[model samples]
Target: MEKVKRKIIKIDEDLCTGCGKCVSPCAEGAIEIIDGKAKVRREQLCDGAGFCLGVCPTGALTLEERETVPFDEHAVHEHKKTLADKPEYNITMKCHLCGTTEHDRPLLPIKAKGESDWVCVKCIPRLIHG
Candidate 1:
C-alpha cells in the first residue's frame, strides 16, 4: 500500500492526564491509556473521524496532516478482536456522572463525598470541586 498524507490523531503526553475520556469514543479501539498516558496503539486503526477530540478536556488530542500509513479497516477489526479476547476487556462499569460505560476502572470513587457513585477520570475535577 502506498503511503498517503492524511489526517491522524496526535496525543501530547504532557497535556494528557490519562483521564481516559478519549478511549471509549474511539470505536476502532485505537486509543488506550498506557502508563497513565493516552496513546494511539496503531495508526491504521484511526479513521480521522475526530470522535475522540471533543471529549478530551486537556486538549491533548489533535488532528494533524502527515505522510504516513493509511487507515486499514481490516487491521482495525483484527485489533478489536484481540482486545475483546482479553480478560480485562470483559470488566466494564458505568460512570455514574456521565453514564458512559467503560472497560477500565473508574478514576475516582466518590464514596468519601457521601455519594457511592463512581466518576470517570475526565469528570473527576467537576465532581470533586463543583
Candidate 2:
C-alpha cells in the first residue's frame, strides 16, 4: 500500500533539553524524546493538530511535510493504552492540593470545566474547597 503524506514534528536536537514535556498530550504516541530531542515514531500516527507545538516551551519541535508509514488508528489506540500502563514520566500539570504528579490524569475530573489545566483528583478538593 502507498504510504500517506503527513506533517511530522521533529525536535531539533541542538535545542531540546530532554524535558519530556511533550509526551502526554500526544494521543498517537508519535513523539518520543531521545538523547534530549523529540523524535516522531511515525508520521502516519501524527494527526498534525499541533497540540504538542503549544506545550513545548523550548521551541525545539516543528512540523515538516513528508511521506510517512501508514498506521491503523485503532492499533495506535491500543498501543497508547499499553504504554500508559507502564509507569513512565507523568505529564499532567501538578495537582494543587497535595502537590502530587498528575501524569496522565484526565483534565475534566481534576478541575472545573476551564478553571485550570488538568490536575490530579486528590487536589481537586483543595482547588475547589479553597
Candidate 3:
C-alpha cells in the first residue's frame, strides 16, 4: 500500500498502562493489547476517526497526521467479521452507573426511569437500592 499523509492513531507507550481500555471503542479493530501495551495493530484498519480517544484512562492514544498506510474500509469490514466471534470485542456498551465498559466486564441490561441502560454486576446492588 502507498503511504499517504493522513490522521491515524498514535500510541505513546510511556503513557499507556496496558489497561486495554482503548480497544473496545475502535470499530475498525485497529488497536490491540500486544506485549502488555496498547498498539495500533494495523494502520490500514484505523479510520482516524478518534472514536477510541475518550475511552482511554491514560493519555496514551492520540491522532497524528503523517505518512502512513491509507485506511482501508474493506479491510476493516473483514477484520470486524473476525472479531465478531470473540467475546471481548462483541460488547462495546458501558455501564450507565459507573462508566465501566465491556472491556472490563459484561454489562447487564437494565431499565432505569423507563430508559434501557447497561450496568456492571458491581453496580447492580447500588442501582437497585438507590
Candidate 4:
C-alpha cells in the first residue's frame, strides 16, 4: 500500500459539531461521526469529489492536496454492505417532549391525542403525573 499526494477531505475538528449532516451525502460513506466530531473514517473511501461539502453547516470540511491513499471503489461498496447488515435505527430516538436521547435512557413509543412520540423513562413520570 503506497501513499501518494492527492486531494482528500480535510475535517477541521475545531469547527465540527458531530451534527452528522455531512455523513449521508457522501455516497462513499467516507465520513462518519466519531466522539462528537466529524471524521474522515477512511481516506481511501473518500473520492475527494466534495459531494459532502455543501451539507456541512460549520464549514469544517475542506478539500486539500495531501499525502494519502487513492480512493477505492471496492472498499466503499464493502463498507456500505457492512452498514446495511446492521440493524436500522440502532442510534434510535430522542424524547419528543424534552429532547432526551435514547443514548441517555430507554425510549418508549406511545401515542396520545392522535399524536405519537418517543418518550424516555424519566419523562414518563412527568407525563403521567401532569
Instruction: Please name the candidate that would achieve the greatest TM-score relative to the true structure.
Output: 3
Between prediction 2 and prediction 3, the one with superior TM-score is 3
**Each model's lDDT:** 0.76, 0.63, 0.80, 0.77
Per-residue CA lDDT of model 4 for 1-130, tens digit only, reads 8998998999999988888767765767777787998888789999899866665777788899999998899998888887764432134467888898867887666657634456889889989999
Q: Assess the local accuracy of residue 34 in candidate 2 as a C-alpha lDDT between 0 and 100.
A: 70
- Give per-model TM-scores: 0.65, 0.61, 0.71, 0.64
* Model 3, CA-based lDDT: 0.80
After superposition, which runs of candidate 1 have C-alpha atoms over 4 Å from their true positions? 85-130
Name the lDDT value of residue 111 in candidate 2.
Answer: 20
Arranged by lDDT with the best first, the candidates are 3, 4, 1, 2
Decoy 2 TM-score against native: 0.61
Clashes of each: 0, 0, 0, 0
When summed lDDT is taken over every stretch of 10 residues in candidate 2, the lowest stretch is 107-116
Which sections of candidate 3 miss by over 4 Å?
95-130
lDDT for model 4, on a 0 to 1 scale? 0.77
Score candidate 1 by TM-score against the native: 0.65
Which number leads on lDDT? 3
What would the per-residue lDDT of candidate 2 be over residues 44-111, giving only the tens digit for each residue? 66777666775666677778777766656876776677676544434555555455654545332222
Native-referenced Cα lDDT, model 1:
0.76
